[model samples]
Target chain A: MRKGGVVVRDVDSEVLQEVVVLRFLRNLFRRKDTVEYLREAWRTKPSIAVAEKLFHRLQDTGSPGAALAFIREAGRAYPHAQRLRDLQHQALRVRSSEEVKSLRAALAANPRPEIYARLGELYRYLGHCEEALEIAREGIARYPQSGGNYLAIGLVHYSRFLKTSSAHDGLQTEACLRQAYALDSASFKSLYYLACLYVYAGAKPMASECIARLAELMPGDNRVADLAQRAQALPDSPQGTAADYFRLHEARAMEAAAGAPGRAEPFAGLRPGKPLNDRLARIAALPGVDGVCVLDRYGARIAGAGRSGDTACNEAALQGMLEGARVNARRMSIGNFSRAVLRSKDWQVFLYELEPYGLAVMGGRTARQDLVQRKVTEFIEECLCEEQGA
Target chain B: MKRILKELNRTAGIRGSMVMTQDGIMVAAALGPDLVEDVVAALASALLTTVKRSFNQIAAGESLSELVLTATDGKMVFLDLGNAYLVVVAKRDLALASTMVEIQSAAHRIKNRRASTVQRQTAAAR
Candidate 1:
């Protein structure tokens, strides 16, 4: 039930609050016929419930669009209601590919990670590992606290490991799998992914941990449990594709950067042939790139522009942006926006994803947005390519 | 009418201008980009009518403040300001977060001016 990779949360808070207030207000009104007032609240409450039932019914009949329309209209009539949203989630299962595309149109106001995770699954099911990897990364970025998000990220990497050996980034892939394990060792998806990584990395002990955890949580998730058992049953040695599988990633990155706007615009104030300075220059001059800096995924700035010398806060802001971008893309379906532009009258931060490395573009409030997106998109894709090459 | 609207647009970041009859006729207007001031000035009455309904629901025993409609075009905002005018501000790619601060500022200043002007004219006639 994925539409534009948005995950509807368990409840809509505004609606619950409003409904409670309405009940209190009705009670406070003086001299109304007892049955009349109670009946009115009852009538109003079920009006929303009826909408939910109708939406679910439509979804059951394979009409997610109609269900969504029903929910939207119900939401307008009852803007502060949780049940209406619950009903919308129920209809998500009936969605079609076209509905998923339309859901992207609503990403600006969309903030659901559950949808992103589901979208990743759908893509993976369709054998689109690259897309699945991209969105799963985005999903994890937004909701690091979500066990589901972590599993999605791990699954992408594990799947990559199963693919072309020369097309995956093992170091970053392991990091992603670790995060998945950190959140929920018992998750079937995470255990499956972890088993794959462990067998690949030749770390049977870690593989055993994943197996034990899976047994505790699912008890009958024998597929991964059995895989872990098989790895243990065999020698604790690694054997798979000869070359590393990070080449394709690097190629994709290069393709993206080479295609970036202002490809050779003097790297924006920084001259070429200056060591990593050229990399910094290239990052800055990227279209939609507001500013540039390098960092680990944990937000430790290595090098770049616009630091103002406050390394501590700059790093914190960078990490926050990375997480925020992931969440933003998942919730809104903006298509893997590790690059974000947070602007007020005061400050702004732009974050971009580049595998084990992170690229951040930040500036004052007056930074040009279009120029920044184009540039950051270029740099991110390029960085991914470079990291894979290394 | 042109003079009255001149004062509104020249106030600050007023990019477009218009004047409307209570029945939604365009007395005079100036607009920019793809927007037509007369058409918006006509819709302005309908928007005001919506505001009137909300006002009635409140039972505040006070007057209506102002009506504002805000929109985006991927990069900036096409903000409909005041009951008669629509101002389209070129903002960030994400218009909501970008133009909101500016739109709110513009709305507050113009709302006070228009509300007080209507009150003053009504009082003068009395």
Candidate 2:
């Protein structure tokens, strides 16, 4: 026999007969009998084609879970099969969609707080932030005392905060989680999320308090322990009270919201001209400085001095580090990440965040830290002044 | 080892201190009520791993020597001690010049003590 342009060796007669019967039954619209026989055939002598057909039949018969289970089993049996892997992925997506459809239908039939929370969580997990936020907010409006909706809201905002590093999102996440905690202090999910938020925000004392409480609630839970460990590693939020940090960020957010062209958009109008390039070159020429590059928020090189290739490479690397640093800083509820000095035995890289742009200065190990810092600070101030003046 | 950390913590503006292997295993720690030893060790290790990886990519062969993260709330100083590291958690207003001297002294003493103990162990085996 030939299959998909490939010659196949002689097949087992019994297996072939079973496939023939299964195909005939499926053709006659005997899906139930066909699935039964397919299952029996699979147990007796499993084949990829038979498993695929069975999976389709099961899915058509409204048994997604069984279809998924059978497909997974087939996947395990044929670990190297790309077709099975694809089918498995398809089954998962189908299952999730079906679940959402059913949940929505049920919710329409009878709106409930728990249903709203579940659907919101599902939407959030699916990356539908707007829908998740809407559903969560709706749930909150209907069931003002329910902590689950607040948790859903907090989680959605937390994910947004992670992506945008927006202090506004972080503050919203904190507020929602805090409200959730207040509604039910002993709730494990609320405490866990609250602990996680504190750890990220670099609120050590607060995280510790949450972790301690969680420990009391559930002794020896690995999650609590892991959280406890993470809380230990939190960098101190740059010197400021949490209130002060949030207030500063809030004011900046407000400014941005009001179309004030806040610090983050300082160079919105000014293109990278010769003067800017000259300034970068001068910074690069400073004693011990090897290279200097300015990068826009999107990690695009705005202006700098160096071999183009080297600058691009440095820009990509520095941008990634800068992003990581920004997220970390925001997580810790630190107002803003102004600068970082990364030193190794042979090199020292200074990174500065000038709102809309990032500045990277590469230097030798012997670079005078104080001089480099002062010059960079002065250079950045000068650029901002020039841009603002322009 | 704890004594060394305790001594280091006595420095003004230093909130707490710990000595841990490069992988973040706690060797010794002298911390205040606000600090937890295992948590600090794990957190330090996690941060070091990230910093070391980032540094390697930027400057291929050079190993990180020190990492000083000055955040709004406080400062954390991580000093490389060959196989181990010294992590000092200090107030943001810490006098870097004076506090670093104490931290370096503590790190040196830890290294010396380890060396002497290894030498003594070699002699006993012989």
Candidate 3:
């Protein structure tokens, strides 16, 4: 049987028939805003499952960027909602191919502020600085109040500054970053970049200010700690004034640009469809592997995959143990605690500190701990290199 | 304690500060009305206790000078003061090093004052 000229074999038996009806009406009336309003209504309700389903539908209809925007709107009502936060992270970790296709399609079909910003980020990540800047400008033009677009523009300019050592570019980057921070003080990206730019500019006080804000935004972040250390290391007195420093920096930038050499694209070997979690899952699938996880400096699991019965308990234990090691290291004046390996007759456990994050691997006694460690290091290097390369 | 905390708050980004006993009692605080000083004290005390235990178990030595906890909304720094702890709440962008230095100085003053008062009480008893 058919209703409203659409096949409906079990419309009455559907779980969210209202969604189906809404979609039908939306299609019939060709009114996108009506459906968006309904989606907003659904968001106000505390239904994670429905929200997840609608999120998937939104992704299917639009793109990950669109899905991100929808979830961001939903997030206002449920600020501390964990699932929504996880979904947002998932959207950000989009497979490259899928992201590119969807972003292009989304922009072509119906461009929105988030799509433009995200696309600009992807371009920046891929080292297409010119394209990234163009997209950022378009995004700014479309969404004047959007701090993220400004951040993207700032990042692009910062990257150029790194390449050419241009004082003008550095100033532009700083201004854009400051604007971004002014608009949205809560964002870690803007604050982090501002701190970094300040440090490079030898503005210790300003750098310290940015670092403090970043620490609050992402507590226990190693990057913030590193910036803090750098700020502390700056001398109380400098030889030159601000103008003189910029002039010197410009001279150096010109010299470096004149000797420009070919370099590989950032994220050179990072193919689409393989995120850090997927990579960990692959490692877990190796023979004799019991469990593997990626953790932050604080020992909180960023992602993990395992066959072990007590994965959560093991991770928690490791976290506590790592904290103990760090404390001991600090007391002993032994510098940073990099790695710890525990081997017993039954199993072997390995923990490595990948700055800003940690990698924990555990397996049976007969397992290839060496190979696992190598793989972990390689994966970590790839991520770091991607970040630095960009 | 109020005077010290108020002075600390004069520095930009310092939200508030409090003094709490090791047993989780709130001695004094300069926090805002929206914040429950007692609850913060209790949580800080509990966290410090956990840190101490972790240190003991690891044999990392006895002197646990301070604790810093970073969260999304704010940062908390707990300075150990023998019988009590000083908890400082500040925004993410606050100058942490200088603030820590200021707190340590204030903590020293509190300890000395308490020590002198204890000595006077002992003399009176004699």
Candidate 4:
């Protein structure tokens, strides 16, 4: 496979590494005493697989949330183990049951910040604001230093703002998000919410700063583009804060989780751009067009074809050209970016801002633009169809 | 002067903060015991200069207003102060948007004070 103009030749070797790891884990898992085997494996190899197996075994006893509680409790005992930290991080995303009983039980067993954070978020998600606030207050009091707790509190306040459209709740949301970001600037959840909050508050400068950082954290994520466009569209202090933006984000996330038309579709089954690459190859085989390149919202190359020699089109250069044109288009107050045609001494580059992705087709200047445009449109529509079908 | 930074530090998850001149001379710092004040000041100065230079390179006449570096271990934020720069070392998961606003406000307060001081000096000289 070619990535960034370089051929990746280690596919077999990488597959072998995965196979070896699973095989080793399978032998250990097949043992009569699984718990002891996990302990021994954790003490020896200390791999992610060991932690995963432990989490799985704990899941057999109860919910994944309960499994996480057990892992976190075990982590306290094995403080020096690196795998424990890995497990702790993984525990944040683990979902089991959001029912009041399960949450309260998990909280009673392990009153750690992770449980508080999860319970608080679940409460907020379920529209139990009072319960969420209670959990947030208790968590903050217990783990004042934990950023995740602050993030939960911030999220709960944000929920309030969305519900009541009260300026007080909005301000509280801002303060809480600030505190959460202060506690951990690297938290994507905090950064993302803060950016969206700023958008609603009509603080474009601050929103842009947050979105830029988020772009760095989650490169190629389509949501960043959506958030950025929404942020830019927001007028400072618009009548009735567009609460629907947050709901849109939530709806998209729910869709993504359900294997609908979202980022997950591109990455879940096939490697990103694997399907796109197949389409690009067909475009490359077309006469006149020298190469076809696709870039994500952040101008990072998703996939490319051609450029086998010095005279062929380079993906990175094409990406830069498209980005420059995009910035210029925004600066000029162009309603929206449609197409850019760059005539160069070597190649004629055609750029199109496909929603969530950038498309660049480089060909000889004499190449038919009419034919190329049709082909590009056909390719984009087909890719969109694939995502919808997926 | 120190009170402003101290109040900022009282916020949850802020590990340390430092104020330094453009030349990297440390003016004040409320850093943790493990961090060296002068070293952090120097690094902050270097990061600011490098970032500003890059911005200038990309778009002439443009200067950097702020910079945030997030690492797995922690986060560092630099806000451009008129006569100096404020560098804050925070937790990796710090709420960056609010923190940036707080830092920017602090820098604005410092700038206002300096402007008032200069005005008073001018009146006194007259």
TM-score of chain B of 1: 0.47
Q: Taking the tens digit of each residue's C-alpha lDDT, what string does model 4 give over B1-126? A: 677787778777788887898788998888877778877776666645543443343223344455454432466666767677787777655666577678777778777877898999999999
Ranking according to TM-score, highest score first: 2, 3, 4, 1
Off by over 4 Å in 1: A1-99, A102-108, A127-134, A137-141, A200-202, A238-390, B1-126
User: In terms of lDDT, which candidate is stronger, 2 or 3?
Assistant: 2
Q: Which lDDT tens digits does candidate 2 get at residues A1-390?
A: 899999886769868998999999876886444788789888998889888889998998899999999999999999866456656756866776677799999999999989888888877655455678878899999999988899999988776553334667778887888898899877898788877766655667777888999999999999899889988887666565544544555465446534633234345323577767766776777888888888777888778874334555666777876766565554433335556677887888887766656788888887777777656644643543343331
Candidate 3 lDDT at B54 equals 42
- Runs with alpha carbons beyond 4 Å of true place in candidate 2: A1-264, A267-271, A306-309, A328-336, A387-390
Q: What is the TM-score (0 to 1) of candidate 2?
A: 0.48
Poorest stretch of ten by lDDT in candidate 2 chain B: B67-76
**Which segments of model 4 are wrong by more than 4 Å?**
A1-390
Indicate which candidate wins on DockQ.
Answer: 2
Report iRMS values in order.
15.3, 5.8, 13.1, 16.4
True-vs-predicted CA distance for residue B57, candidate 4, Å: 2.4
Two-chain DockQ for each candidate model: 0.01, 0.14, 0.01, 0.01
Q: Which tens-of-lDDT digit does each residue in B72-114 have in candidate 1?
A: 1112122233454433322123333433565556545555667
* Alpha-carbon shift of residue A46 in model 4 (angstroms): 48
Candidate 3 residue pairs that clash: A212-B92, A212-B93, A213-B92, A213-B93
List per-prediction Cα lDDT, in the order shown.
Answer: 0.51, 0.74, 0.66, 0.64
Report the C-alpha displacement of residue A188, candidate 3, in angstroms.
23
**lDDT tens per residue, model 1, A9-107:** 546686898899998987687544333343354366647656655655656666568668767777778866644543443344335345446545544
Better of 2 and 3 by TM-score: 2
